[model samples]
Target chain A: SQQGEEDPQALSIQEGENATMNCSYKTSINNLQWYRQNSGRGLVHLILIRSNEREKHSGRLRVTLDTSKKSSSLLITASRAADTASYFCATVKGDSSYKLIFGSGTRLLVRP
Target chain B: DTAVSQTPKYLVTQMGNDKSIKCEQNLGHDTMYWYKQDSKKFLKIMFSYNNKELIINETVPNRFSPKSPDKAHLNLHINSLELGDSAVYFCASSQDSQPQHFGDGTRLSIL
Candidate 1:
C-alpha cells in the first residue's frame, strides 16, 4: 500500500512562476523528505523536515510540514527551466526509519 | 567522486536467465538500500542493509536476492527472471536516518 499521495499529478508553468506540490500521508511519520528526479536519472534529495519542525528552506526550495493534517508541501520559488523534473515526497514511519514509503510523484514542467 | 554508483546502466536479458546488478557507495554510509521503479515511475523499497546485515526486506520474491559484502557495497542477483521483472533499479545510501543519496539507476529489460 502507498503511504503518501501527491496532488496535481502534473503542473506546467512559466520559468518565473512558482511551483507548488502537495503531499498527504496516511499514518504518523518520524520525518518527511522531498526529492527531485530528472528524466532518465535518479532522485536527488532536496530537503527534509522532521516531525517537530514546521518548515525548512534550502536556497530557492521551501518545504512545509503539517503533522496534525498529515500533509506536506514543496515550493520552488522563482522556478527555472532547469527545475523541470518530477518531485516525490517520502515518509519514514515512526515504527521504522529504515524503510521509506514514496508517493506517486508530481511532474512539473517549466516552460522557457 | 561518485557518491553512489551502480554498474551496467542498462541490462537486456531473456526470461529465465540470471543477472546481477552491483552497487557501491563511497560516502562511507552505514546503511544501503535497493529500490525498484516501475514503468509508472513509482518507486518501492526492495531491500535494505546496514553494516552488511540485512535489516529490511519487503514482499519481494525469493528469486530476488540482495547481498551486501560490506557497508559500502550491496549487490542484487535475480534468478529465473520473468517479464514482469523489467524495471529500473536504484541504489541508495544514507547515514542513520538522514537523507539518502541515489545512483543513476540500472534499467533492466526482460525479453
Candidate 2:
C-alpha cells in the first residue's frame, strides 16, 4: 500500500523559479526519502530525512520532515529545464524495514 | 555499469500466460525488492528478499512469485497473468535497508 500522498499532482514553473512539493504519509516511519524519475526511466534517489531530523539539504534540494503531522516537503531552488520529472516520496516504516512505500508522485515541469 | 538492472524492459503478453521478469543488482546489497506501479502511477511493494530469504510479502496474489537464486539476483515470475496485472514492475536494492536504488522497470502489458 502507498503510505505517502503528495499535493499538487502537477506543477509547472519557469526556469530559475523555486518548486516545492508536499507529501503526507500515515503511520510512523523511520525515515522519508524523495526520488526523481525522468520520462520512461527509473527513479533516482534525491535525499532522505530521518524521523529525528527536522530538515536536510543537498545542493539545490531541501527536504523538511514533520513527524508530528506525518508530512514532508521537498523544495528545489533555481529549477532548470533538466529538473522536469516526476518526484515521489517514499517511507521506511518500522525498525530495519526492507520495503519502501511510495507516493503517487508530483509531476514537475520546468519551462526553459 | 548499471547498479540495478532488470531484463526485458518491455513485455507484452496475452492474459493467462506465464512469464518472468529477471532482476540483477550488482550493488552487493543485502536487500532487494519488487514494486508495481499502476496506471495511476501508484507504486506498491510486492515483495522483498534479504540474503535470498523472503522478508516482506504484501497482499499480492499467489500468482506472483519472487525467486532469488543468489543474493545478487531476484526474479519475479507470474502465472496466469490477468489484464489487471498490467503495470510497470520495478526492481530495487538497498544496503541495510536505507536508500534504495531502482532499475529502469519492466513495463508489462497484458493483452
Candidate 3:
C-alpha cells in the first residue's frame, strides 16, 4: 500500500521559476526521502529528512517534514529546464521494516 | 561505476512465456530490492533480500520469484507471464536500511 500522496499531479513552470510539491502520508515514519526520475529511467536520490528534523536544504532543493501533520513538501528554487522530471516522496515507516512506501509522484515540467 | 545495474533494459515477451531480469549491485550493500511500476505510475515493492535471504516480500503472485545469489546480485523470474505483468521493474540496493539506490529499470512488455 502507498503511504504518501502528492498533491498537484502535474506542474508546469517557466525557467528560473520555483516548483513546489507537497506529500502527505498515512503512518508514522522514521524518515522521508525525495527522489527524481527522468522520463522512464532510474531514480536519483535527491534529499532525505528524518522525522526528528523539521527541515533540510541541499543545493537548490528544500525539504520540510511535519511529523505531527503527517505531511512533507519539496521546494525547488530557481528551477531549470533540466529539472523537468517526476518527483516522488517516499516514507520509511518503521525502523524494523526497512521498506519505503512511495507516493504516486508529481510530474514537473520546466519550459525553457 | 554504476552502483546498481540491471540487464535487458527493455523486455518483450508473449503471454505464457517465462522471462528473467537480472540485477547486480557494486555498492557492497547487504540489502537489495525489486520494485514494479505500473502504467499508472504507481510504484510498489515486490521483494527485498539481505545477504541472499528474503527479508521483505509483498503480497505478490507466486509466479513472480526473486532470487538473490550471494550478496551482490538479485534476479527476478516470472513464470507464465500475463499482460498485467507488463511494467517497469527496478532493482535497488542500500547500506543496511538507509536510502536505496535504484537501477535504470527494465520496461517489460507482454503481448
Best by TM-score: 1
lDDT of each: 0.96, 0.94, 0.94
* Model 1: TM-score, first chain: 0.98
Q: Which candidate has the highest DockQ of all?
A: 1
RMSD of 2: 1.0
Docking class of 2: high
Tell me the tens digit of each residue's lDDT in model 1 across B3-109. Answer: 99999999999999999999999998999999999999999999999999999999999999999988999999999999999999999999988899999999999
| Chain B: TM-scores of all predictions | 0.99, 0.99, 0.98
lDDT (Cα, tens digit) per residue for candidate 2, span A1-112: 4578999899999999999999999999988999999988889999999899999999999999999999999999999999999999999887657768898899999999
> Any runs in candidate 1 off by more than 4 Å, and if so which?
none
Between 1 and 3, whose TM-score is larger? 1
Count residue pairs with overlapping backbones in model 2.
Answer: 0
Between prediction 1 and prediction 3, the one with superior lDDT is 1
True contacts kept of each: 0.85, 0.92, 0.77
How far out, in Å, is residue B44 in model 1? 0.3
What is the DockQ score of candidate 1, to 2 decimals?
Answer: 0.89
The interface RMSD values of the models, given in order, are 0.6, 0.9, 1.1
lDDT of 3 by residue, B1-111 (tens): 988999999999999999999999999999999999999788899999998899999999999999987899999999999999999999999988788999999999999
Candidates sorted on DockQ, descending: 1, 2, 3
Candidate 1 chain B: worst 10 consecutive residues by lDDT? B92-101
After aligning candidate 2 to the native by TM-score, how far in Å is the CA of A83 from where it should be?
Answer: 0.6
